[model samples]
Each structure stands twice: as C-alpha cells, then as structure tokens.
Target chain A: MLAKEIIKKIKDAESNITSVIFVGCGASKADLYPAKYFLEENSTKIRTSLYTANEFNYATPKAVNSNCIVITASLGGTTPETVQATSKAKSLGAYVITLTHKKDSPITKDADYVIVHGFEKSYAEKLEKMIYALQLAVEILNQFEGYANYEEMINGFNNIYDLIEKSAATVLPQAKEFANSYKDENVIYLMSSGATHKVAYSTSICLLMEMQWMNSGSFHDGEFFHGPFEIVDKDVPFILFMNEGKTRPMDSRALTFLKRFGAKTTVIDAKDFGITSVISEKVADYFSPMLISGIFRVYAEQLAIARNHPLTKRRYMWKLEY
Target chain B: MLAKEIIKKIKDAESNITSVIFVGCGASKADLYPAKYFLEENSTKIRTSLYTANEFNYATPKAVNSNCIVITASLGGTTPETVQATSKAKSLGAYVITLTHKKDSPITKDADYVIVHGFEKSYAEKLEKMIYALQLAVEILNQFEGYANYEEMINGFNNIYDLIEKSAATVLPQAKEFANSYKDENVIYLMSSGATHKVAYSTSICLLMEMQWMNSGSFHDGEFFHGPFEIVDKDVPFILFMNEGKTRPMDSRALTFLKRFGAKTTVIDAKDFGITSVISEKVADYFSPMLISGIFRVYAEQLAIARNHPLTKRRYMWKLEY
Candidate 1:
C-alpha cells in the first residue's frame, strides 16, 4: 500500500489505538527507534515501545492487544522472529503494519498492512521504512491527540529527501577522511542523543561491526557523564552525533568533554548539514535521523572501501542457521 | 521511611496512579531496569519508563503528572541531574519517591517520600535501592491491577538476601578463575535477556569499563543474532547471564552459538545457585537479577583484586568536573 493510504487507514482507526510498538531485528530494529522516540516525545496519550523482534515474541508485553498498533520491518521480510512477532501481534488483535523491501513476503502474510520499501532507488526511497514508520507516528499523534507542528512535519517530509541527498554530498569529503583515519582502529565508540541515537547504533552494529568486523559500541550522549565518560582518554576515537533538538545540549556537553580530554572525535551535527534549512526548527529533530541515515550510508561505504571489505561480507549470517 | 511504609502510602494512592517512571544515573539507572521490566511485563494498565537522570530532566516525559509515580535514586543523593529530575517530577505534580543512602541528601529535598536505603552492612543491604524499587512494583501491581504471583514475589524477596549470599559464595571460585583468565583481555562483551539484561549492562559500564578501565560492551541476547554475533569467534570472551524467565530461551540460543563457535563464555545461570529453591518457579525470573547482582559483585571484586585496581579507583570521576 502507498504511504498515504496507510495513513488514511490509521486515521480512520485512530480512536481505538492506545499504544504503539515497533519491532524488528538488527538494522531494522535500530531504524524503528526514531519513530518510537518521536511518538514518545510528542504524544501525551499514546504509549510507545521499541523491542528486538525475538524479545517481543518471547516476553510479549501485555499491552499488545486490540488497542495497540504494531509497526514492524524486515529488509527481505523473511526474518523468522519478526514474522512470528507479526503473527502474534495480529493474533492479539493489534493493527500490524510490516515494512520490507520484498513484496508479499512471510512477514506481510500476517500484517494488516504491508509497505514495500525501496533500497536500490533514491536516498529517500531507501529510507521508506524509517520514514513511513515515523510518518505513522506523526499522523497518529496529529489525528488522535492533536499535534501542533503537523504542517511543519509534512513540509519537512516533502523536502527531507532532497536535503538528505545534499547533506550526503556535503559530507563525502569528511567521510573519506574518516574512513582513512578510522579504518585500522581496534575499536570505535559511537554516541548520540534524541532522534539520532539509533542512527549511531545501527552504524556501530550493522555498518562497523558486521560489515567491517570491528569492535563497536554505542551509548546515549545523555549517558556520557554517568559512567561512559570514564572511558575517554587521549587519542581515544569517538563518533558523536549532535541533534538539533531539545536534547542537543546533552550532545554538546559530551563533545566539550571529549575535546577537553584530547580524545580524537568526529562530530556529526544535523545543523552542520543544514537540516533546518528545509525542515522547520519546530519539527526538525524528527527528521534528523533521515538525514543522518543517508549521510552515514556514504560514510559506511567509504569505510568499506578503505578497509577492502564489501558491505555484503558476512561471517555467519545466512551462511548457516543461526 | 521504611519499605513497608512506602508500600502503604502507594497502596493508599493506587487508584489515582496511571504510570510509573524510574530515573537514576549509571549504576542507579542500571539497577532500576528490573523494576521497569517487571512492571512492563505484568502491568496492563500502568505505563512504565526508565531514563538516565539527566535525560529525565532535559526531555521530561509528558506523562509526568498527578497520576504518575516517579521513583528516582542517587547513592549519595547528590547527583545534580538526579536531584534536578526529582525536583522536576515533583513540580510537574508527579508523586516523587527518592531513594538514597544518605538521609538528608539534596535529592530528598522535593520528594513526597524518601527511602534511605542501607549500604556497607550486608550483601542484601547494599542492594536496597533495587529491592525497594522492585517491591514497590510488586505492591503497586498487586494493589492496582492484581497479580497472581504476589505471594511468591513477597516470599522471594524475604529469602532473596540469603539466596544471594549463598549464590555469591558458590560463585567465588569461578569468579577468581574468571579474574585470572579475563584480567588481561582488551574488551569483554556481556549478554543476557529479560530481567538480567541490565545486569550485564551495569557490569559492563560500571564494573568493567569504569572500574577496570577495560573496553566493554553489552547487548541483549535477543539482539545477538542480529548484528552483534558477527564479532563472536574463537577465544572471544563473553559473560552470558541466563535468566529463569520466559525469555530464557533467547539466552540459551545465544549460548549454544557461542559454544559452537568456540567462543570463551562464562554462563551465570540463576538455576545454578538454586534461585527457584527460594523463589517459586513461577516468580523465579523476577528474582534472577537480585541473585545475579550479588553474584556479579563478587566477580567484579575478584577482577578488581586480580588487576590490582580498586573499585573506587577513578581517572576523572569526582577529581575533575566535566
């Protein structure tokens, strides 16, 4: 179904929806986070949760019932755990929506709606899963509980793809530099807050660790002062994502600490890429992840090239039953 | 206030409560996860959230209101972020409960109730913050929506300290062995699911990285298959916490893959220490974290000793303000 059609269906059923749950595995799970975070931050009446697919199935929340909306995704739509989760949520009478790059896959079989996203297309097309899930959150809040920045969100979506493409091009030089400098590092740590937190996470797990076989970890920038800051030292490589949102102070604080401690750091600020140029400041934070998603894919590709490793290389995934 | 007194007050206000929010930092934040997890798994009516203290203050949830219960903790009760969060929650009309080891700490200033938890006395005493928060969850559920395992939970709590002590003793030899084997390792990865997920997380951030200055990362066992498992290979050191909960199968599956790949793993199973002997099989999952918390402290202490690094040793914490 088209994204607009999906939104229309949800708008028709908004009165019965009391909660939203996002579930997937790996990158898909990480990608769902922005949508969950967006709904949690804005909606006063709707409860939101994000869980890895298997955990959602194994320890299903009691809130997964007729009143809940479950948004799930799988790249190929064949992830067993996610498929099972879709079936379970459907059985529990949740309005299940599944996003995938393949049409009519197993995951779509149990979903109330299926959005076949694109990968080998434009940057915005490639981010359909994240964008669609995020749009659903925006529309749900706007229709059900009322959102003040609804028009701004819609405008931002219209310009986000072009903005992301332009941002990706602007960051290519730095991406190459980062690839050369960080390719041989023993371990890399990523940190971010607000909407871009899961962008850093997916970059760490899927792009860096899985693709490059490098040790990586990601933490919320808000958590830096807690215990994670203890790990900083001279020349310690760090990647920090600074948001253009209410939590931006947390990211800036961490950056100041990293610089003061002489740690080698790379800062990916949404403001640096002119995110606010197209996205209204009122609703820019929710669109930051879409820009970061496009920009980081360029970075990850450069890193793969620098390390002489293809993004498709995998040690155990799909080569064996795991 | 005594734990029972706190429970009585919550019971008195049960009908007015619609949500629960747990906030703290570092170890305290980590300790609050079990309560959040427990409430999420069992409560259908109440919404629950856990956040780092600063995040709670910066981007306060809109759900904080007269109908919300906020449980926050800071060991010394002087963490600026947590104190501010306590004040913020109170100002928003949420019933704020503060837990601290110091009676008149700053965090207690705006709290509706203050529970001065004990430390430096006994194993169970050191875990008062976690226990009290958990007990509050149990009581709230029992009084509000009703829980079938209430008696078992209370019984488990009564015997938990003794069970934890016994479990710590049983794991002493292995802790020492782990200290010797893992002392020089560059990075240690920990994994668990359900109730024990944050136990592994706290061990990584607080014990391993902050205390030992070793690189560390932790992931949920459910997420291991997603992207984290790519880093698993021969001799890769992992500390896996296996729960006795509904999600135990997730941990077991990860363990099987780790063993098959010849990855060095230290499996800490709640059943190993006879947790079900004291905690009924039905409620054993909720008690697994308490047992793991005590047992892992022993393991962390052993690692500290073997590395000649005291747990109190710090590079920048308290010495310099960021």
Candidate 2:
C-alpha cells in the first residue's frame, strides 16, 4: 500500500541531510534490467552500511540520527532483523523505509515507505523481480529536478543481465569442474583482488549460508602474508580471482601460495567471466571488489548444490533460538 | 633464522618494481604489513594488487609478464599456492619473492628472495613483535634509501604496543559482558563501513576460524538495503563497528533493523570508546578501526566457550597436511 509513498520518501531525503546512508541486505539492490549488476554498480553519494539483520544495536552517533533514513530489504518481511531494527530506527527518530513483498509483512508495517513486490519466489526469481522493483522505485525517486535521464542509466541494466546470461553459459561448466575438485576436499579457498575482493567475501558467505557447509574465509592478497599462511596445505582447494592489472601479482601470488600449501588452486578472470561482471569497472570507484562479488549468488548456488546443500525450502530459514 | 633475509627481500623489491603484484592467502596474511596500502597511500603512480594466494593462476596479461614481479606470502613458507605460483612466475620471467617464517620452508628454495620471521608467545607480544618485523621490512622496502629513519618507525612500534595494551585492559574486560549477552543466544552479525569494512570482514573470519561456531556475515550500511534483510531474527546477537563522523547512521539503522528482527545489535564506536583516539588520526585512518574491531575476538571467544566450542589452539597454529 505504501509502494507509491516509497518514491516520495527517497526523493525528499535526497539532499537535506549532510549525508544519506543506504542500508539493506542483498535483496535491497537495484536491478541492471537485462542485468543484475546495477544494484551494486551505481554511484551513491549517501553514507551507507550493509550488514546482516539485528546487528546494529551498537551503532555510534555517526551511524544513526534524525536526519537519517533506514531502508531495509527482505522478502518475508518477518525476518528478525527487519522486525527489530526498523522498530528501533523509528524510536531513535530515523524514518524507516522497507522494500518487501507484502505491505502487511512484519518489516513493512512500521515503515515510513514500503515497496511491496511479488518477486518472492525461489532465490533466482527472487533476485530478478526484487531488483526490478527496486530499480523502478529508484527511477521514480530520480524524477525530481537534476535527476538526469535516470531511465537511460537503468536501461543499461539489460546489458548487465545479458552479460550474466552469457557468463553463466561459459563459466557454469568450469565452475562445475572446480566444485567437483573440492567435493571431498573439506575446504575451498577463494582469493581475489580488485573489486573481486567483495566477491570473495560473498562467495565465502554463501558457502556458509546456503552452499557448501565447509570451513571458508576470504582475504585481500597481501593481507594473507600477515598470518593465514600457517594453514595452507595440499588438501585444501583454493580459487583465485584476478582482475586485469590492478591486483596482478596479489591475486597471482595467492595461487602460488596455495600450491606451496599443497592445495589445488584455480583462477578466474573478471573479463572472461561476464555474468557476475555486474561488478565490472563501471562501479569501480565507489567500492572495493566485494560489491560486485555478491553476484556469486549464481556461482554460489552451483557450489551449494555441488556440496549437496542445494538450499532447499526445507532448510530452516531462521530457526533462531533467541 | 631467515627472518632477516625475508625482510631484506621485501625491502629490496620496493624499488625494483615498476608494477608490483602482491599475493597471499588469508592465513599467510598474519605476517604481512600493508606495504601496498602504505605505498599507494603515499604514492599514486606505482601499481599494486594485494591478492590472496591461488588467485594468480586465473590472472590476465598484466598479471604475468617478463616485466612484472610477483611476490607471495606464506607463514609456513609452504602454502600449496606459493609453491605453485612461484614456479609459474619464474617460468614467466617475473621475479619471485617469498615472505615467510621458516628459512627451510619449501617455498624458500624456489623464490628469487626468501624472508622469514617468528613471533614471541604472548598474545600481545606475538602480534606486536610480528607487526614490528613487518613494518621494519616494508618500511625499508618502501624507502630503502631512507633506511636510517626506519628505526624511528620501529621505535613507534613499541608505542603502538603500549596503546594496544592500554586499550585491551579496558576493552577486553567489557567484552566479557558483551560476550555474555550473546553466549546463550544464537547468531552473531558483524557490520561496518569504509576501512571498518575490513574490520567486519576480519571479524567474520576470526569468529569462523577462531571462536564462532554459529552464523555471521558483513555488509555495508548502504548495500544491506538490497537483500540480507530476510534473515534478521529478534534474538540473534550481533555488533556494528560504527566509524566516527560520516559512517554512523547506516550503522545505527543496522542496529535498528536487527532489533526489528527480534535480535539485539551491539555497536563499538571508535570515537567514544577511545578506539580512534588511541592512535594519531593519520594512523587511525589506516589501522585504528581494525584494532577496535578485534575486540570482538575476545567476545567471540567467550561466546563460543559458553557453547563449549571455545577458541582453541587447533585453528591457531594450523598445521598443514603437507
């Protein structure tokens, strides 16, 4: 019911505050249209933070205030974080905006603006639709003066989606091979540089959240030199992601280090792997590689199933004891 | 025994590189000092890529060439990655440099230069001594010509140790209370923005690798709006590393969001907690937040131990299956 009000909230908040902080989980992202990368690619001047739900109780004054607006994303609307953080933001004087599937859902009721969408299906469809709705909502918000032909920018979304489709075709087979290599291997190591650092983070997260229930972690190339080197072994399988020139040796050396540990190591190039390329150089200046790396949702699904997790609905979503 | 040589190797490469590629795994990073961050923070012309080990195998042209130099880090000097990548770099005519703690490490024999180091036993001592060694090595490499003044930086190292000791005195004790709050509860979330992002990432990794036996993840305040909202729970325990000034609202909102999910989020503010205050603002720009965030390590330990998992020694000096 508040979907229309959603645009008004975002528009009004555009310039007044000293800064705008965009906060959401993965579902809050904008769609690239034909592409899914747009959500992570856009240039946002606002102050922003994205973290799992129910984790912000410790925020400093710099992170919350009356001038601020909190936008949260989740399909079910009843997620523990949505229920708690939204309520708290309002108590703290910050307006709350939520993008979800139902206006009646738990996360939406207290929102100053709520964009209720139907993109609530399996994970893949969930991404396609949620991103689409958010992009449209964002487009409407851009309608005020000085908002350049935002539609044109949103149109590029298609290019990203097309690229993802193509990349899936190319990398899927290879990813399958990589998955098999690590099947019984116990641990799969992901190493990356550039914007890919974010991807490594997301991929590792997915491995824990829905994919392989294995021991996993990510690191910036040279950072590993600080301590992680003590555990490298032949049985651990490692994967390195390299962007053209930015982190050449960093990502490369990770491959070498894995070999020394006796783990099997594989490398993925950002250029050849276009699907997740939503993280391409387009949004490079705004973020580290992990922004685009979230696209590994696709790659993660494959690996998840490869590890026999397959992320079924039967798998309890929250099942929180608290 | 080879620690001195390892330092020399790093120092030697600082000037030789026209374009440098830095690489290693998450664990090997225990010994690395941010020479690249330091170099890039100071000079804009030099190209650098600090990557995780095993990432290079997938790198593009700029990553490997006769002119490019590749450096890999491994604490044990035997990460499977370092060995594999060293051979590749050599075959490609790229100079190879290895940094580690063992002179007899398998990685040492093949590298063009090998450097090694070991730390003292106490928690603070191990971290402080190793960090100083890395600084000594990189500072010398960053400006080998200014080796004379390098001693000044090493002198400052002891000051950092004193700062950590002071902070740990107050920070660690309070962490016990925070840790107790979540010990019986399920889930732990970590979040932050900017350099604090590294803290969030590192926090997640530390929990998983060290004490955490449950769930955790990181997201930017701005990006969390897209999707992660679905998982929030009212009872899940979490923390937000609120950076001072520009990055707080999102942090606060994240806290709010978590509360809405029925979870309580804790925040560690750098400004109020004497975190950013301990170090000079300039140094705080690069390192203070990480130290502040490490406070979670103690809390995580308490949380895990409550559940009987307790951060133990097994994952500490992880021995590879070589």
Candidate 3:
C-alpha cells in the first residue's frame, strides 16, 4: 500500500499537476514503461514519461516542473543515479514519491514521500513488488481524477495476483517446451504492444539475455512491421506477448505475419490465462501486463535451466565495475 | 523545408496548443522518438508523445484534441495505418501535419498540411529526410515561441549536412573493420542516450538486424546497467553512440564502464565528426543525433556489403501479405 502522505499529496496537487514522471535505473526503469502505459490509458489529463535516473538528473528543471509528480522505484533503494534524480527533482520544486525496499536507503533520504515495499531475494520477486508499486500509483491517479474507485481496484489487484499465481501451472508446460525448443538458438525475438511492451523488453534484456546470457531482440508490435520483421523467417524463433487491450490488433497483425512466414512463434496471450475471468472485465486490460510478467518469469527460469546457466551468473553486472 | 501553410496553421493555434503527437508506422514510428526528444529538450511549454499509427488510430478523440498537433511521416505515403491515423486525427479535430514524398499520397489527402521532401531510394536517405522534417518542426515551434532563430538554424543545418557527409570517409574504415570482425557473430549490442537514443534503436532494428540480418540489442545508456550490462564480456561486441549534449555524461559513464570491462566497443561520437565546427554551438546539441544518423548509415551499408547481403533484400517486407 502507498503511504498516507503520498495519497494526500496527490489529492492536493491533482488539479494543478499536468505530468507524472517515473524514474528508476535498470529493471526499475523498464518497470516505468508499463506504469506509463497504465497512466496514459487511464488519465487523459496527466502526461506520463519514463526516464532513466541519470537522464532525469541531467534533464531536470527543464523536463520536470513544480506542477509535476516524480516517482522513483529502486528495489535496493541505493542506486546512485536514482538517489541523485530524487534530490534533483526535489530541488526543482517537484513532488517526489519514492518506492523502495528499505526506509533508510540513500533514495529515501531526499524523497518527499516514501513507500517501503520491503525486499525480495530474486529478480522475479523484486519485479512483482515494483509492478505493485506502479499499479498503486495508477490507482491513486485514477482515483484523484474521479475516474475509478481506488479501494475496489486495490482489492481487485489482490484477486488478480491470485489469478496470476494460478495461471503459472498452465503456463509452465508451454514455457518448458519453448525453452527446450529454442534453448540452443543464440538469438531470439520478443514482440508485444501496449501494457506488455516493457514486459517483453525486460524479459529479453534482463531475464533471457542478461541472466541467461541468451541473445534477443525485443520490439513493440506496432513498430515490428517497419523493418525488424525482415529478420523473421521460418528458422527464426520469436515470442509474441498478446494482451487483451486496444493494442491487441497490432500484435495480432504481427502474429499473423510471423505465422504466415512459418516462423517458430510462441504466443503468450492474456486471454488464454483467463485474465478477465479473475479480474473484472473493466480492469483486465489495465492489469494484463502485470499478470503476464508473473506468468512469463516461469518461462525465463525454464529457459535459464534449459540453457544450463544460473540466473545469477554475470560477467560484468556485479562481477565487474563497468 | 516546411510549407508556409503549415507554419501559419501552427502559429494560429500555438496559443491554445498544449501537446504535439508524432505518429507513424515501423521505422517511421521509431523516427518520432528523436523528434519527441528534440521538442522536449527545446520546448518545455508543450507536451510531446510518440505513438505508432495503429495506437493513434485507436486512441482517437481521447488522446488527441483541437489543442494538439499530430505529425505523421511516411516516405511513400501509402502506409495504411498512417493514412488512417491522419484521417482519425482530423476527425478528432486535431491539426494534422503529414510528411511524405508526394502531395497526392493517401496520408496527404487527409492532412491539414503536407510537406513533400521527394523520394529516397535508401533507408539512410529516407532517415535523413525524416530527421530534417522533424528539425524543421522544432525550429518552427521554437521560432513561434520567440526562443530561437529559425532562418539561422536552417542555414546552419546546411553546413551540418556537409560536415556529416565529410565524416563518412573517416567512419567507413572502422565500420568495415567492425563488419569484418562481427559479421560472423549473430548478436551485437548498441547503446546511446538522449537525442541519439532513437538512432541506436533504428540502427539496430532497421539497419543491422533488419537489412543485414545481424542480431543486436540496443539500450539507452542510462538503462544499460540495470540488468542488460550483465551480458557484456570481452568477447561480446557493442557500439556506443556518444553525443555532445546534456546526456553526454550519461554515455560517458557507460563508455567508461564498457571500456574498463574490456568489452569490444565502438564509439561513434558526434564530436568525432566535427559537429561543433560545422554547426553553430547554439544548435549543435539538437543536431547531434541527426549527424550521427547520417554518419552511421555508411556503416550499415558497409556492414551489409561485407556480410554479403543487400540492404534492399527482405524476406517478407513487401514480398508477402500478412
């Protein structure tokens, strides 16, 4: 849950504020894209932007405003760039809302309002926590705009979480097969649209490529047709994250193209997981990516095992300074 | 150069306008990111967004308004989604500005103002045209706000075009060496920040991966460390697009990390091309990526040739129907 101070701050600034900036580093930064998608789809009154912590630190005072709400998320609460960005946003007269696992980390020091989500030992666990934090912000903003019932939405997330956990059993077998089929292939592509855009990004960059040391190219489905589709052929393996939302048609078009080309394609459709059956149909589209992330992590884990690499293995991440 | 009617239309609505939406399909869609970056870096008065054509068509009246200007770029101007998006923007009462190669194209028919830049036979040439169109819009808006000298900027761009062309000779040898070294490898990484961010994306997806059929991963410099950095090793090759701007320090940090780790890194810096010497210092930062795009295209072509492939070759681009 968000801090009481944060809700009160949003309530106070709701009318004047025209923008919300989500700032973070690494996986934390990718998490902002979905939050951005959520806020953009829900609130037409507020503009949402995703910025990496370092970019925010440099672009501040010009990119942010006194009439803006800046949100930062760091699982460790100690990322130097994020810490600096939060301070910069505060100095620029913007409201700062920070989400971290610890109350006393460096990022918390300069945050105007801090929500401590506690820690997770694994990447997937940390990702889930970050998603919840973003989902909470979406609820708060929607409530502030008088567009939705915040309390009901929060309760609905609990049900959606349970449903996501339940979908793992159904997703695991297919994920295992996919991993077994494509494990030896050095390069793969992942495509998605709308809310699941960042999920595809993180799954490729963070989970598969980084954690497992597999190579990948991930793209938004709408942009898939322009040129990247040329790389897709019968021998190329790809994954399509299809969500039940306005962007579904775009993904469907790409999927049809991929299938028609006889490319080895994996489809992770939210509807297959019965997302609407668990969450209210009204809110299913908003929550699709969060649910998909939970379901997809199983695939990443399976892929890592199939590739014979531990997810914790790293060459330059924690092993080297650069 | 932008047509007069477009300038007059923007000047007329400049007082009421609060947002500008850049819409396109594929490479056209990715091109909007740089334009969005330019507007954000220069003008803080208006909100800017990059939307794919399909998404814009669906977002419709909710995402656009009379107070918004929608800009779409399509080289041939027959992209079905882009044409529909332009029409949809008109229907939603948003001022529509379309960039295409012909005045009578489908997109131009629905657009309030259309600027035809003539047909480009290659991706690089088309990219140059799109960048110029976006730069022209940036100048027009900044001039309308009385924050910049439009005519001087336009004249300066002429000098920049010559400088970028001059840099091609210097970049080719290294590009040829890079292509030879990595042509056999399936995957590569590209990293950049700020204005050059989209250049990295388009270069990876549109040029190397799509045209040459090489696999690549591209990340914003600020975002490279989150998780993707774990994939880097002495054996893994990466290209870093370093620009001379506010976001330079961000790229420098990543470059330091990259070099220290002994990863094979190619640094394509704006300064290396004598950008400041050719372009006015006042406008050099905004012109960095455009320069990079021009300089980088030579490498893409060289790489394509070295890999024994033609840039125009595609498996399904225009060869098949989805």
Candidate 4:
C-alpha cells in the first residue's frame, strides 16, 4: 500500500485544509494526536470523533463546497465508518484522503488521495503499519519539512531500540519477579510528555497490545488533571517518564504525587535519573529516554508472551460491522 | 478574556469548520452536536488532553491557518491546556479560533474564527463554551442549510446542560454513587464506542485524576476483546456503552462477557438500555455526548470536592509567551 502520492498529498493538503477530520477506530483514536493538539499545531481546523460507519446516516460534519479535508485510515479500508464517511464527505464536497493497508479496496478509489501503509503482511505488520500510517499522517504537519526531524527521530528510535535489546537480555531473566512485582495490580498507567510523548504512545500501544493487557491509559503530566488525576493511588501501577526537557518540576511532582497514591511508579529515564553511582551519560532528551520506553515495551512484551498472548492480540477476535 | 473581534473571527471561521472541532478541559470540549451519532459519523481528527499549561498542551493536531481547519475552547483564556496548544498551532500558521470567555486572550489572535460563548461565569462556564463552540462549528458544516442540524444540536445541548439544575438527573445522580460504588475500588474500566467513546475518556480522566488521584485506563470493546479481554474477568469495574447505535453489539458482548469476570459494568445510555448503561442518554453516541460529558465533569468534580481534596489541582500549570 505504500505510495509516494500519499506522502505528496499529505504535504500538499496539510496547508490547504481550512478544516480537517479524521475517521478511524481502536488504538487509532489514542495513537492519533489529540484533535485539539493536532489542529492547533497544523493551523488546519481539526476535529476528532470516533465514528462507526453504520452511524454515517446520522447528521455529521458538512464537507460541502470544498470547505474541509477528510481523511481515512483502515487496514482493510472497509471499516464501516471509513467507507461511509468518505462517501458522505465526497457527497458534501470535502476533499478526502485514505490511509490503509489494502490500496485496492473500494475505499482507496473513493478517496481523493490514498496513502497505503507498507508492512501489512500479517497482523503484527498490520498493527505496526496502522501506527506507521498515522504517524506519517500526524507528522505530515512537520515543522521541519522534507522529513525535518525524521533523521533525528530515526536516530532516537534506533538508540532506544538498541538499549532495549541489551537491557532485555539482562533484565528479562527476572521475568518471574517482574511479573510478581504487582501482585495486586489493579491497572497500569502510562504517563509521558515532550519527547517521550510519542514514545509513550508507542509504549502504550505495545503495552495494550501485549503484556499486562490490563486496561492502560496514556496521558502527559498535564492531562492527569481535569479528572483522571484523582484515581492515582497505591492500587494502580504506573509507568511515568522523567524528561528534563519536558516538565521537570511536574515530572518530579508527579513522581511524588504518584508516590502518595502508593503506585509502584517505574520512572522511565536514563539510568542516571536513578540515583546510582554509574550509568550516567549525556544524550539528547528525546533520544536517550526513549530507550527506557523501548525497554519497558520489550519487558512487557516478553511478560505477555510468557503468558501466551499474541503481540497482535489473536487470543480472541472481534467482528466489525460486516 | 472576552473580545469582540475574536467572536467575529469565529463567525468567519465557520466556513472552515468542515471537519475539525477543538476540545479541551474547558469550553472546547463542551461543544454539542445534535446527536451523538452525528459527531461520531463525521469526525476525522482527535486531539486534546491536559496542558503543559494544563498538561494537554502539545498533545494536539498540527496547525496551519489556511490549511488546518480548527476549533478551540476554554472558559478561562488562562487554561494551560488550550493556551499552549493554541499558541503552538499559531506558530505553525494555524487559523487559531476559540470559544472563550474573553476576547484578549492569546487564542483570538491566532484563531481565524472566534465564537463568544458569552454566558454567566462559573467553573461550569466551560460547559457553555464547549457546547456552543462545538455547535457553531458543526453547524457551520450543516448541509441542511439554514443551519437546521446546528440549531437542533444547540437546542439539544441546552436541553441537556440545563438538566443540571436537577440534582436527580441521570448523570449527576449516578455520579453521586461514585463513593458508594468506586471508593476503594481497585480497578475501573470505561468502555464505549461512537461519540460516547469520549465518555470513557472522561471516565478514565476521573479515575486517574480524582479518587486516589491515580492512573486510569480506557478501552473499546473490540480492543478489549483482542487481548485485554482476559483481564475483564475479575476485580475490575467497567463502564460500557449501551447507546442506541451499532456500538451496542460490541458493548453488549463486553457487558455480558465482562459480567462473568465480576467486573462492575455500568452502561451509559437511555432507559431502554437499562441500568446497565454507563453515563446516560443526554450524553450519547453522537458529538453532543459532550453535553453528558459536561455533566460527567461535574460528577467527578463533585466527587473530588466531597473527597475533601484541594478541589482545584494546580500542580503542573505552565507559563507561556503568548
């Protein structure tokens, strides 16, 4: 499904959008930028709502007269919502784009632009592709242009990936103890911000998709308020990030706050942040700490696999609107 | 925080409301669609959470004024979440628009459209901003012409929001059960679909931000079934969607299945769905679910107040240049 035209369309349509809409389901909701954040970042008018194609007949956003842009991302391109919304948007006169694993699907033809995600050979590949496609979509509002921070992001990703691999070799031997760490574990919270926010997103995806498949939540240091902050206590196990480049005091305060809740909070950061005598070195905040996220994913994935759950979650399946 | 030109800008930006609607801790999230189904059917982008200002900052969509269609809401221009995200988007050439309590705040200048959610001031003023701002936004997209759906949505919001005057209301009263049902509760799950998806978003927010002031998780039935399904068997309290839409099947499967695990499941929907409902009908599957989402805030807020915590959390607030 990978195509240069999709990337070009992303580059072209990002600026032309007076308003933008996103249609998808499942992890896509959490993985995509918060509408408020994405729209505010892109200068495009944006709104995000979870749509079910079956409900497309209901009154929805008018895409008439070339007023806005509507985009779709579905591995199958057959999600009822994606299909119906594209049809509706087209009828309303809005420009449309499709991001999917199967480009030959009907959705691709209906869309004004189709971005195909590569690596959909299997469920794992499809899941990763789902992430990649949206990342590509979200990052399209790139500030640097021409893959500005892409190289940096790749470097960061590789660094984290390597560290995680090495760490998993050593720490995963304690899989039983790691599994025993939370005897009464009620829930797992993934807290991240700044550079690690996207890392947290990836971490969270791995988390929900793999180990501790217990319900998980991902939020920045700032979002814990407005309501969810009230639930943090000893019963919940939290995975929080400490980024000096992000919110230092709050990250620290969050550690303290989570501590008061009695959550066995595992701080994700460079080993130096751990008050040890060694393992301290300087690396870009975005790159180094990301390794911790990757490590956590590795550990969690191992734990989940030991427990026998597919990283792509095949234990049980769900049926969408056929 | 209120300004005239900003309001004028909002009216002008209505044409840009093709697909995006901005939501946050304040008025931004308060916007209501005529039906939950409508919003669910149309949305293509999703963004918002806390602020670096609110902890939700930077966790949004990209912005480019002419290119990005956008919506923003905040009762107080000073809210960290909206301000920072809005400012960042402005830097990206976003047409910053807002539903705010003031005119002079940073949002008006950055936004192309500014809708004045001019109303009585209170912590709840945020509700007005969210609902009306969203209504105006989606109304601007009305294909019905003469804004029929827009007017219906506005009326629907008023119908629901005003219900707040009654203490016995579904959402408010059910919220009163928080202590009885959730206090000391180890794990809680918020399940939903369609526009009500954010209903769980609010629930997850409360769990993490209020009770033990801890971490929380949100899951859809399909995702929960994929792998996380096994966790629903015990010790988990869940809130599921029993809305009048296609979401019912999966949610029902979750409800029926999760009940076997001893997880407390609350279904939010009309009476037809039974006490199994999660939030309530006033807040349903379409975009206007935010109306019920508004009440959910008060529900959680009242719980927080009753818990005798600080009531207003001021931990991670940020300072911005705007």
Q: Which ten residues in a row have the lowest lDDT in candidate 4 chain B?
A: B43-52
2 or 4, greater by lDDT: 2
lDDT of 3 by residue, B255-287 (tens): 888777788888889988777776676666667
Kept native contacts, as fractions per model, are: 0.61, 0.10, 0.63, 0.43
How much lDDT does candidate 1 score? 0.86
> Model 1 reproduces what portion of true contacts?
0.61
Positional deviation of residue B222's Cα in model 2 after best superposition, in angstroms: 4.9
Give me candidate 1's interface root-mean-square deviation: 1.3
What lDDT does candidate 2 reach at residue B229?
44
| lDDT value, residue A23 of candidate 1 | 95
DockQ of 1: 0.70
How far is B195's C-alpha from truth in model 1 (Å)?
Answer: 1.2
Q: Each candidate's lDDT (Cα)? A: 0.86, 0.51, 0.75, 0.50
Using Cα atoms with residue i matched to residue i, what is each candidate's TM-score against the true structure?
0.97, 0.50, 0.92, 0.64
Model 3 chain A — which ten-residue stretch has the worst lDDT? A118-127
Tens digits of per-residue lDDT for model 1, A41-111: 66666777888888899889888998888999999999999999999999998989998999989999999
Which 10 residues in a row give candidate 1 chain B its minimum summed lDDT? B1-10
**Tens digits of per-residue lDDT for model 2 on B1-322?**
2434544654465444444556665534433433444433233233344445554553432335554556677666777766777777777777677767667788777778765554334334434323533453444344532333344444445455555555555666667777677666534556776445555655655554344534344555544443344444456556777765334556666666677667677777766646444444434433444355445555665666566675554432454332
Give the TM-score (vs. native) of candidate 3: 0.92
